[model samples]
Target chain A: MVAIADSVPKPVARFRFILDRRNVLGSIMIAPAILYVLLLVGVPFLMAVYYSLSAYTIYDPSWSFVGLANFEDVVQDPVFQQTLYNTFIFTFGSQMLGLILGKFGALVLLRPFPGRKFVRALVILPWAVPIALATVAWQWMFDSLYSVINWTLIALGVVTRSQAPNWLGTPHLAMLSVIVVNAWRFFPFAIVIFLAGITAVPQDVLDAATVDGAGFWRRNYQIIMPMILPIVAIGLVFGIVFTFTDLSIVFLMTMGGPVGATSVLGFAGFQTGIVSGDVSHGAAISLFMLPVLFIVVVAMLRFIRRREV
Target chain B: MGSGGNKNNRSVTRRSFLKASGAIGGAAGLAPVLSAPFVSRAVADNKSLSIVQWSHFVPAYDTWFDKFAKDWGDKNKIAVTVDHVPVQDVPARAAAEVSAQSGHDLFGFNGSGGAHLYRKFFINLADLVKETEKKFGQVTTIGKQLGYNADDGSWSAFPDFYINFPGMYQKSLWDGIGMKPDTWDNLRIGGAKLKAKGKPVGISLGHSNDPSTTWRGLLWSYGGAIQDAAGKKVVLDSKEAIEAAKFVAALYKEAMTPEVLSWNDSSNNQYLASGVASYIVNPISAYRTIQQSNKKLADDIFVIEPPKGPAKQIMGAASEFYGIWKFAKNKEAALEFLKYYRDHWPEAFKASEGYNNPCFANLVPKPMPILANDPTSTPPTKMAILQDSDKWSAIPGYPGPATPATDEIYYAFILNDMMTKTATGQSSAEDSVKMATQRCEAIFRKWARRT
Candidate 1:
């Protein structure tokens, strides 16, 4: 039967003989992407994971298999614990502030008001400015001796002549200052997202709710909020991730100082790995965030999925 | 025949697909590899030197390599180029370059990071010095001292410049208050007057890597140090350390702005430039920075040897020693460049506009141009002030010692955190010092064991 089929030009044989242009085009299209992901993402990620398990100090080229030693050291470190606490505080504080301010700003700007375009552009100014420049500007504004805020407070009799507030000196205040800076810098992103979400709300449903004697608070809380929950969740996730992982602001602003008061995990990792030449310890510190970040991401994804369902 | 043709077509299509995929893969991977050879060739062909050095050093020396380049290149048919990088990023950049085994031909570093970490990356300059000295009639004593070694001449550092932290005060401010801050105690009294005049005496209690230097100076002046003569163990928790801490705490309480804790690395310059602080312990770099920003403070600002403490000893931090990379492709050229930098001290000093202090004892015999007592250059009293620098100035680890671990602890933990705790009233000086000492001991032991 095989010999007979080979001899005969059957319809199936004819179809198989023709080139599948779709398959060729599909392979050609995906070739670059496959190569990109493997080279860029897969290779580096594998290296990072491999390095994470090894004692890879930049000072020394000789790396030994330390197993989970780096992780154990990180867990045992008091500085790591402090860093975790600071990271959480920074992430949560900045995200919450960003959410509130961003939503409010979005709502106010959503309506057709005078100078709305100008105000919208101004709102984005903080986000648009380079992080280093913005942090430097904030550092100057919060200067201990000659801060504009201190001068204003003193002039207004809010603070006494001798009671100048050290905005970035004390630990608590330094943390607060960094959180404020992060919130100010990133809130514009939230605003833009929230604004898009708000605009996407159905006008008919809102009108119906208003006709049913729903007040602004009721309409916003019950109607508009549920509709925009997914967007808000996305904004929150991004805010948390960005804040938790950020080092530049803390580095430039305070360097996690005034006694490690504002030392976040990201900054700690950088300080240990790069600054102090303790790559193993730095890697350990950086990986400490994995579990917490995993928990955050998982929780957010579940919420979004549930909302979608 | 038809079946054979069909089989051949399928095989060709598969081969073509594989070839296409392979081409894409090769293109993606080949860029960095292809560029590597070119980079290597460029590095080999280039006779020009690029250095990431301290900002202050650039002004101190005239990089008149154009003449040398023309002469040397004409003689040897090789060209030379030089560029400077900001000092702060030098260590990290050098580390990256060294790890990659690429980048700058030379990098300048300070004593702490330069000696501790950068040493591992740098080539031993002992032979280079010996060879250069054989030709140049014995290299400068400072260079030899910086590169000295008893264990088969394994030293790597090449001494470039040195500066001491003198108590830079507004002389007019002190004289106007009828208060002389000759001693550490006197600073408290002077600080009180300054505070009364609504200007708190500025001192850098700021959390910074430099804080270790400040703390060490205070500790040394109080007869305390991170280690003793033997350099066997940590001594940060001693009575003198406690006393120094208490003194600093009191000073902070009375004289310093609350903002000192948050001040950036440049805060010392800011304090003096704004005329808010009456005194600060800074290098001549601070003086230069302030003069550049506000020239009015040039004469009003005075440099005094660090005030005497309970121990009656004045102490200050020394700047970093410049070293050549061990794996530097142009090691000979780098050494030659350093030799040029050292030999032309007078020219370098004149070019720097008298900002850099010469490391060589002979070259700085009477204090170079701007530091001289000549009426045309600077005030006679101004030159007189630097006279005590030779006596008071000492590197953190000097007189047969290396305290890399202690220095690291001092910067990373003690100065960055402990100082703030004491100053902010969060912890007592004794408690802070005690805790810091225990921490320092652990680190020192760990490091000692490793080395």
Candidate 2:
């Protein structure tokens, strides 16, 4: 042991050697990024946790430590429960629909077809549009009186002029509209990811599958799908996270209205924290989703590992 | 070997000391240097004054602000710029600025209760009032009328404009019904007739941000008060309130379309513009929009004082008041700009093009004639609605002081749940009121202590 220690050299000497010119330069190069994350992200995350445990108002200077009172209140609050349920519905509904549409869209575009490139380009239009402008356009399309949809329906004689439906007035319908809008806006991302995944599937595998007498759907399900399952899962996770936290669509479109049918966790956080000036409650509401989010992330990681195995 | 080792040790010590000291210095110096730009920018920009006020107030009062800015710049050697933001963003944006401890010299908000809710961020205009009144005769008259004593001089805001939310209808439609709506009960009958004729009457019954103003207007018209004079209690569950709720529910059942539950600030205007509805309980702003947007309809539209209820005739007052930021670097300039705005009322009124009526009774002897000839103004009848506004206007929190909980209850409970449930027939009017009252009492109790 003494001989090995002597051969290894003194701790100070080892430290000096590790901090030699090359390593020092590398450390210096990465320092800014490290410090940036530490200051901006790490500090704020710590502060958010601290605030979640306290009763703080931006309007008032006095911040009292309320322990788990805010969390308890959030659990008891009916609005919070409704918002949580809406958030889950919005995220899951949009992600599933988006994935299916995106996958199908990518497959359709993959085949040599007329105006394939143009169609692919057009597919991205919804994603390209600004949320505010898109929401406003949707608002016009769904207008109770002058909606294009209503006009079209009336013109087609599918519905009488007097029977024009109020698309955003009904509670269930409003939730459906928001989910549809969210799916429309985010589905292009899924399409792009799935397209990349599909492209990565070796042409040799397809040739082999064809030689094995596998049909198109059979080949897709057996070979292409298993190969890209990880990517699809990744896309699903991202979609769920984005939809769960989104506020602009619901805020600008329905404002969590039509009797709070569209209210989600994100909207509740914004209203409670920013609008009502109850920062603690808002922080608490946001933290309410942390455990669920953690579970999803862990599940996603486990799924990816299983896929690798 | 000894010479080389001593040389290495000297170099290492010097380098280590330099690096440690440099890091310490950098960390220490970072905050001030980074903060300098913000501080210097604010100081350098001190000569300039920025205002976020109602759209009508800025455009209508354009010549006044322009002339005043030029004159004030020449006289006081300070440049001033006025900007207009929509009315809805005024409160939220102002609150954000206050939180950031920056932005805007003068910010205008909707009502007295709103002003009080954000009182912590505002400078007491008492000193400014003395300075202004000494220079100009009176910069604001409504301030005095609203119990803001310019003599004792504890004013925080300068009252700018006033609006009344009463029942407005298409005069042609009402005339077709062969009955004029003179009382509050007349709304139900007229609305039913309109519905029979295939038109739904539009009324806002939602838990929107503006619910307090909209629903409170209906409540007061029915002789319901949120509280008595002291404002220290909640009286929203009173018999009068229940009666008003029942009446509203009946109106919703008979005449109003399902869309009323989804209406927000722009819904009433949209309803009138699209001709989807014939009558609505809304502010003059809606009437002004219709008049400007569609002249043909403007001629047929008539504004009526709120219908007399079983107990009284009441209307909700929608007004904008100006307050200087307490943390403003240029408080004197902000006050001067406000004074200049007030002094040039005639030009301001002209600029508003009859959209905004001055709250100061003296500045506006009567409503500005609707500029029907100018083609930009709403029709003559639309402009005539201002007269009705004067007769029946209740300030928010009227009969009592406005509380945050009062606004919250108005939005969250009464508008969102009770109104929707009542309209949808999910709950009876009494049950809706009962649920709303229970929720309101909880909120009021929580916030009353805070106030």
The number of clashing residue pairs in each candidate reads: 7, 4
Grade the docking of candidate 2.
incorrect
DockQ of each: 0.31, 0.19
Candidate 2 interface RMSD to the true structure: 6.6
Superposed Cα deviation of residue A89, candidate 2 (Å): 1.3
Please provide, for model 2 over B1-451, each residue's C-alpha lDDT reduced to its tens digit, 9 standing for 90 to 100. Answer: 3323334345556678999999999988897787886788565555877777656533435565566666766576677677767664555676588778988888776644555556567777766555545654454333443325323446657667665566678888888888777775787888888888876788766545445565676687667776665666767677777777777778888887776766666777788877767887776566667766787886677777677777667666567778888888778888887776677766665666654566554555454544223354444344465554555666655666544555454435344566677768777877777767766665565454445
Q: How good is model 2 by TM-score?
A: 0.83
Model 1 chain B, poorest ten-residue lDDT window?
B136-145
Superposed model 1: Cα runs more than 4 Å off:
A1-52, B1-46, B57-83, B129-152, B230-232, B289-297, B374-378, B387-390, B397-404, B410-413
Error of 2 at A45 (Å): 3.6
Model 1 lDDT on a 0 to 1 scale: 0.71
TM-score of each: 0.84, 0.83
Using TM-score as the measure, which candidate wins?
A: 1
lDDT of 1 by residue, B272-294 (tens): 88887788877766776766677
